[model samples]
Target: MDRVVLSFGDSLLRSSDVSLLDPPRWLNDNVIGFAFEFLAASLSPPLSERVAFLSPEVSQFTKCCRDEAAAFLEPLALPCKDLILLPVNDNSGPEAGGSHWSLLAYVRRPPGFLHYDSAPGTNAHHARLMARNLSALLEGDGGFREERAPAQHNGYDCGMYVVCVAEALCEQHLRGCDDLILQSITPQYVTRKRAEWKDVIGELSRKSAVAPQP
Candidate 1:
């Protein structure tokens, strides 16, 4: 993972990063952040303008003071963004790492935050911290809830579930649908994503390689 194999904007994936997408290996910040970059880049203009995606690092920073969090989010135009996809990490207190992953989705239509945790209650605290800091800035949408989501069978797949759920939500919203349908994203589906993500990385890497650089 020392040598960079893919660099899309700020998301960088090293040569062996693709292996992290496979089972029994926990997907790190690189894979999740890159996946988000790919997904966000696929949205149409209007929908794109209304949606936002934050990396786990930035999302965790929301647990800080409101002013700081708001300042960090200012450029994203949070007020106008209806759907904010925040990947949450259950970091050990005052530590630099976390053992669990989840997602906190801020929706303007309902004016509230909804958390999707594949491990159920593991990430609830972190998700609420984000909601507490971001709700007012997100149009006084302080109401929060733990929404039902596709559960992962193994501990290492939580990050994958986060990526899948984010994709599902964005796709549904793009299609003018509100109901979430995650039944089809089974463990097998999650496992298959490794190949799909690798394919996307390969395509993007090729495009970047051919593009003229200054």
Candidate 2:
């Protein structure tokens, strides 16, 4: 997940004018809340204006109480013109194994929320729960939709899918397209991105080592 975020940030810098000077470099499954928060913070103007990201902590809090959750999210909602990416994790306990990652994207053109799950149907209930809370918080008429996104072939790649989907959506938004459907993200793409990330991280490490310490 850490490598993926760094790779995505580098991609953004290369493809566009977005500047991510100190992007998040390390994110593990246990600290996904921080991962989402870091993603939200890393976004720069124009792209940042097109999309907003809610932290996993907000999603977790919504599972407890919708009212309180609405209050909590009310202030964090960004004035995004296009979409809001909300990461959701539905796991009860440590004994229950690893948590699953999914996305709840609220798009503005058609004015509806779409849930993208790599494990399709696994997080439907959680998506609906979040939709309700977001509706109340945003004060929009409830119009939630579910689209089975490109599924992950492995257990650990859900976070990768989330980042990839967000990247695709941002690209689409930049092109002024409302068809928010994710086309496809193949294993080859993931493999290439992993290699690219390794190179990016290696360069960053070398640069840090050469810099004089104050």
Candidate 2 residue pairs in backbone clash: none
- lDDT tens digits, residues 1-214, model 1? 1566777877877766777866688888778888888788888887788888887667777875567888777888988887889988888443336888899998888678999999899989888988998875767795999998999998799999999999888877656766645776788999898778878888888877733322
Of the candidates shown, which would achieve the greatest TM-score relative to the real structure?
1
Residues 1-214, model 2: lDDT tens digits: 1222223322211211111211222223423443344455567776666667665555656654676876676666543447777776675432212357778888777678888898998888877887777777664634988886888777666765666676667656655655544665775564454455445545654554433222
How well does model 1 score by local distance difference test? 0.82
TM-score of 2: 0.69
Model 2 bad stretches (over 4 Å):
1-44, 79-81, 92-98, 177-181, 197-214
**Going through the candidates in order, what is the number of backbone clashes in each?**
0, 0
